[model samples]
Target: MGRNVLVVSTVDHADDTLRARIGDDVDEVRVVVPVVQQGFMDWLANDERAATHAEEEAARLEEELPAVSDARKGEADVLLAIQDALATFDADEIVVALRPDDETQFAERIAQEDLRPSVAGVPVRAVVIHEQG
Candidate 1:
C-alpha cells in the first residue's frame, strides 16, 4: 500500500505543488483546513456562521481537488486539529502548506514548534509557497 499524507493549510494548495513535494508514492491525500477563531465573543456569536463557512469551503476544496478528501476543523487550535486528522485518516506523513506573507506570528510559531514532532509524530514536511503578485 502507498502512503497516506495529511495536508494542513489555511488556503487551498495546487495539486501539482503537492504532488511535486510528496511525489508519486502517496496513495491518499487528505486536506485539513484549520478554523482560527478570533475571540471568545466572536466565536460565541458566529459559531453557526463559522460552521457554515467551513463546510462550504471544504466542499469547494473537494470540488477543486476531486482526487483528495477534504475536511474542516472548527473552533479548534490548528495543532490539535492536525493531531485529530492524523488519527482520523491514519496518515503516514504530513505536509504543511505555508504562505510566508500571509501567516500570522502565532501561525509561524505553531509551524515551528507544534506542527512537526509534537503533533504529527510521523514524518512532516513544510512547503512554503510564495504569494504571487
Candidate 2:
C-alpha cells in the first residue's frame, strides 16, 4: 500500500510543489478547503458565499489530482478542518498549502511548527501555493 496524503489549503487546489515533494508515492489524496467566514456580520448571517467558494475550490483540486480519493469543504477554521479530516481519512502524511503573500487572518492561522505537534505526530509538510486570479 502507498501513502495516504491529506491536504488542507486556502487556495483552489494543490500545486506542482505538492507533486514534487511527494512524487508518485501517493496512493490516496484527500483535499479539504476551509470555508473562512469573512467577517462577524457574515458569520452571524450564516453566509453561503464562503462555503460555496470552498466547495468549488475542492472540486477544482479533485480535478487536478488523479489519485484524489476525497475532496470536500472543511470547517471554517483551517486547523479545525485538518483535525476533523484526520478523524476519518487515516492519512500517513499531512500537507498544509498556504497561499503565499496572503495577508489574511486565515493565512496567519497556519503555522507549520504548530501544526506538526498535532495530527497524531504525522510528518507535516508546508508548501507555498500561489493562487491565480
Candidate 3:
C-alpha cells in the first residue's frame, strides 16, 4: 500500500522537491499552508458587511495556496498546524518546506522536540525541504 504524506509548505512551489523525496511510495500528498490572520480584531469589531468581506478574503487566501488540501488559519505557527493536520489526516509522513536563507527556527524545533511522534501515536518521519535557488 502507498503511503499518505502530508506536506506543509511556506513556499509557493514545493511539489517538485516533495515528489523527488517521496519517490513512488506516495499514494496521496496532502498540502497545508499556514496563514496568519492580520487585523483580526478589527474584523471582529466591524459591521456585518465588513465581517463578510473579511470572510471572503480569507477564503480567497486559501484558494491562492498551491495544491492546498487544507489551510490552517488562526494558528500561524507551522508546527502547531502540522500537529493538527497529522491528527486530522493520520498521515504516514510529514514534510516541511522552507527557504534556504530563511530562518524560521522550525528545523531546530523539529529536531529537538518529540512532539510529532507523540501526536501521531507512532513513528512519523518528518522531512524538511529547503528550496534550492
Candidate of highest TM-score: 2
| Candidate 1 Cα deviation (angstroms), residue 112 | 7.0
Q: What is candidate 1's lDDT per residue for 1-133, written digit by digit as tens?
A: 6788777665444445756776777677787766532335545465565556556665665555434765654333557767778767888888776556445434333433555554546777777766554
lDDT of 2 by residue, 27-52 (tens): 99999887763555665575698789
TM-score-superior candidate, 1 or 3: 1
User: Which pairs clash in the backbone of model 3?
Assistant: none
Superposed model 1: Cα runs more than 4 Å off: 13-16, 37-51, 101-113, 117-120
After superposing candidate 2, which stretches have Cα over 4 Å from the reference?
A: 37-44, 105-114, 131-133
Those runs of model 3 whose alpha carbons end farther than 4 Å from true positions after fitting are 36-74, 101-133
Q: Supply the TM-score for candidate 1.
A: 0.67
Please report, in order, the local distance difference test score of every candidate based on alpha carbons. 0.60, 0.72, 0.51
* TM-score, cand. 2: 0.79
Q: Count the backbone clashes (under 3 Å) in each candidate.
A: 0, 0, 0
- List clashing residue pairs in candidate 1: none
Per-residue lDDT of model 3, residues 1-133, tens digit only: 8777676554444556655766676666566554422234533453354334434543453454343355433234556767777767867777665544344344333322433443455344445556457
